[model samples]
Target: MNTNAEGHLARQQRVGTLIDLFAATVEEHGARPAVSDESVTLTYAELWAKTEQVASGLRAFGVGQGDRVAIHLERGVDLLVAVLAVVRTGSAYVAIDVGYPEQRRVHMVHSARATVVVTDTAAQDSPWDEKLVTTTVGDLTEATADATPVVAPVAAADPASILFTSGTTGRPKGVELTHGGLVNFATNAALPRILPTDRMGQVSSVSFDAFHYELWCAIAAGAEVVVMPSVPELLGRDPRRELKRRGITTMLMPSMAVNHLAKEDRDAFAALRVLCTGGDVILPQACREILDGQFSGEFYNLYGPTEGTTACTAHRVTADLDAAQPVPIGVPLDGCRVHLLDADLQPVPAGGTGQIFIGGAGVARGYLDEPAETAARFVDIPCGSSWGRLYATGDLGRLRPDGLLEFLGRSDQQGKIRGYRVEPFELERTLRNCPLVEDAAVLVHGEGDGKQLAAFVELAEDGAPAAVRAYLSERLPDFLVPATLIKIEQIPATANGKRDNEALREILRDDLHRRERYQKPDSRTERYLADLFEELLGVEQVGTHDDFFALGGHSLLAFRMHRRITRDFGSGLQLQDVIRHSRLADLANALDADPTGRPIRA
Candidate 1:
């Protein structure tokens, strides 16, 4: 056989589909622990048995090939079982995060045409449609079937899952991922090697693409999957204690989390054998700190979008890497291709910047039920000897002299906030539809972790900023909601009728000056917090009552502050405390009220 043919045959024999690879892993590692959360741990054999039972239950309920099952359970062993069960029944799973707004969940289910939703028992009374089959994880686990359900033949190209991403139309688009794409990614050699003895922490939300990285990649290599605690628990808890307690050897954390650990506990990742992070820009200083510390693990900076699987490229951060510039995105994975092309779809000249396009086995099938969008993004391009499809990432990047890919910002209005894709048009449309708003425009402000969504609203006569914010909070996810909502007489427009973002920024500057008045810190607690706020927000002379959000503080920054408070103040303040009591004075008061009367750090 030729080289390509042999590789194809080898892949088919080993992992024709994700299910096949998983089954093989189960057979080899049956006695070993496969996955565990705080509630339960399951060996590979036990996990397979549970998955079989759920698959049988699904088959009995008339779910079969081509069906899409919505999995809305929280992060746990049950969630993993439901996903495997759905795939085993020859159906695709649609992930619906439990924390999503009710309206958003409804839209996702309706858009994906999911007739069945599997949720936790506690969520049985949720507002799912009466006509849909709404079953709980408990029901599936306890279900009895007369005979074992036969496994359906799964094709490599068949859809494995549909992930919802922010869309310009104000509704999320379901990006269909194929079984082949996932299998290719899980087994690809270009990724950081996951050892069988490694215990990888599953931190990403089920709806997030990184969940695949945390679960599939670990399980495929016969590694133990350790699901971390919820967002609240993680933020308040010390990083060094938790990772050590869990015996976590590998973790794919977000860049924000990595940076926080680097700042607070440089040796937090000492127990980890492989530490990989991505989703946002990796700060050079943060990487340097970790590398310089007691962390003896392999550290990598990953980069990719949902359209190109979880991660397309990874750059290992060594002690010798240049600390002057942002780390390169590195080269494509074994089964993937990265192309930097100009407007005409031709490759950019050497060392020139162009839009990044991803092509290969990991490229998604495209948006479900949206042919126009699929055609627009997933286009046929000339490969070496044949025509192949490539997803136009809309992200700008350039090839370095060493052939490594360096990332630039987006080529379009879309931006990434806390690793989630943010479409300004989507936020603007939601704002315009608000009952309190007459007109609205949304723009991204600041850079990196300080980046936040700012909405300029020309409100109706009876509308108020507070009421408008509440309206948006009710409709959109916390990440999607604007951090700053400014009342404007009208949204500025250019002479050519385009939204004049420059003019809007000038108005924002004037508004900031009008609202903010410097008041020096009075107490020791207040002064300490003021210093942190100034350092985090990249501003000086912070007023005691100045709003954190108005000063460009975002969720990531808030998380970092939460960690710092717990460590420095010896308080039990939760992540919500930092956000709810955003003012410097308010936060100081909360910290003072903490029952733990340990003195603040020097």
Candidate 2:
């Protein structure tokens, strides 16, 4: 990045605050569509009215400038309203997932030091009331119906939101973001070429940092916001119906979902003009499928961490990109400089991998309340200003000769499962609480296609697999739950007595390969399923009990398998169900029984 470009990009930060930016949009596109979901469509004017109404109630409830407010609700219009309302009060908002374990939720409420909580009826009985003053959307609306509204005085540097992510330690860490960093993203990086008529799909969780990009980037750019129906909707379901129904012109999705749409529902994304994917590295297969004249939309790859306040790099795919080479994370976002530095803070040679250091205004303030950890990650690099800092992304990458950064892999135990960041340490702590688990160790099981969490447990007594899975399901989000659980007398240790993660991974891999010889398909239906799995997974042989996902079948390939099964077997199976019944035997049984709606497990 040149000095001129740096200054130019840095100057792109123009907005005073996110509220003011969106207010300007509301003024310009008043009658145009703003945000919508399955239930309601709010024009820019209507959304502004609701935001003001909620902001007044928030103020009355004692939320003010510099105070942190927690929004505990699932994704919906009410959720978005509560968020904007909190920011409008000159206070930063924390998006708390309603599904988080009560223990996690309470920890966040106390840790964040939230002054007030805005929740819907779903969280009416939650512990939010015990810690802070709590208000509901309905109550806020009714209370402010007759009251005059006022916008609280806010500065551009004021913190806008706090998002909690898996920390290295057992406790979750809150990443506090400011309006300035967010404004930089929405203005210079996200949807830079966005048109007012373009519709942005909201698929990221309200709690995820990417939600800032999903919602704010569009509204700030004078575009419509289309929220996905639910988390399940964002999963491997047929996107054609939803895309057509919402008239979604743009969507920022995880790579696997993008791959699924292209491979299975090829025509589903016709309504989209721009499709952005990040979270995890996208496979070249996904890009090839989209670029092969299947989908006519532009496919963009976005890259950044919560520390960067959403994506700081974007690359538009081209047909000539090599499938064998690692997909580059693309060039740096405006105002952000990505440096490949060696261990001694020296720049690595071209094509040499190094720790990616992101510098600029895009870097976040730091982790909420964890100054030591924050300081350790955000190093004091030489910049022109007094605040010379850079976020040392633990991720390793290399600058290609073409100037694109190719992501290597993580240098630590933390890994991305599906699209969510999973910290092995945090997951292990959660597992220890389970009565079924007397001792536990979590390790990233595979790389690339088969990447997943594998938990090795030492049981107090014998424990049923389903019983343990059910318990973990209640306590952790679906993504955090280990895909495979193995029982052992004791976890393997190194010579120094520390747990050996490599040893555990080897144990799982050996066990997986040592399973009883592949059971051949007997019946015609079984043979048909086996043949399809072989074709989809590119495996020479597929056993009936073989887990589809474990056999390198991702949701994208699973959707392809689902389509093939439904077409050949006269079934209406869903890709979601196909993932649940992962093995050939289970899927065959599901197809033989009820292939319409959600299939019942045998």
RMSD vs true structure, all candidates: 2.6, 3.5
TM-score to native of every candidate shown:
0.95, 0.91
Instruction: Report the lDDT of model 2 for residue 406.
Output: 81
Residue 500, candidate 1: C-alpha displacement in angstroms = 2.1
Candidate that scores best on lDDT: 1
Across 1-602, the per-residue lDDT of candidate 1 in tens digits comes to 00123554466557978889889999899999998998899999998888888888888889888899999888888888889889999999998888878888888888899979998777867887888898976787677434475588899999999999886556789999999999888877767889888898887778889888888898789999998975435655667789899999998888877776687778988889999998888888899999999998899999999988898887888998788988888888777888888988888889998999888888999999999999999999984566778899999999898878899989988887766789998888888888889999888877876677888999998999989988877878888888778899988889999989999999877766765568888888888988999888788788788878767776667877887777787787778878999988998888888898465655
Best by TM-score: 1
Model 2 over residues 157-219: C-alpha lDDT tens digits? 779988888867667888888888888788774334678989888877777777887788887
lDDT of each: 0.84, 0.78
On the 0 to 100 scale, the lDDT of residue 386 in model 2 is: 41
TM-score of 2: 0.91
Model 1 stretches astray by more than 4 angstroms: 1-9, 383-385, 566-576, 592-602
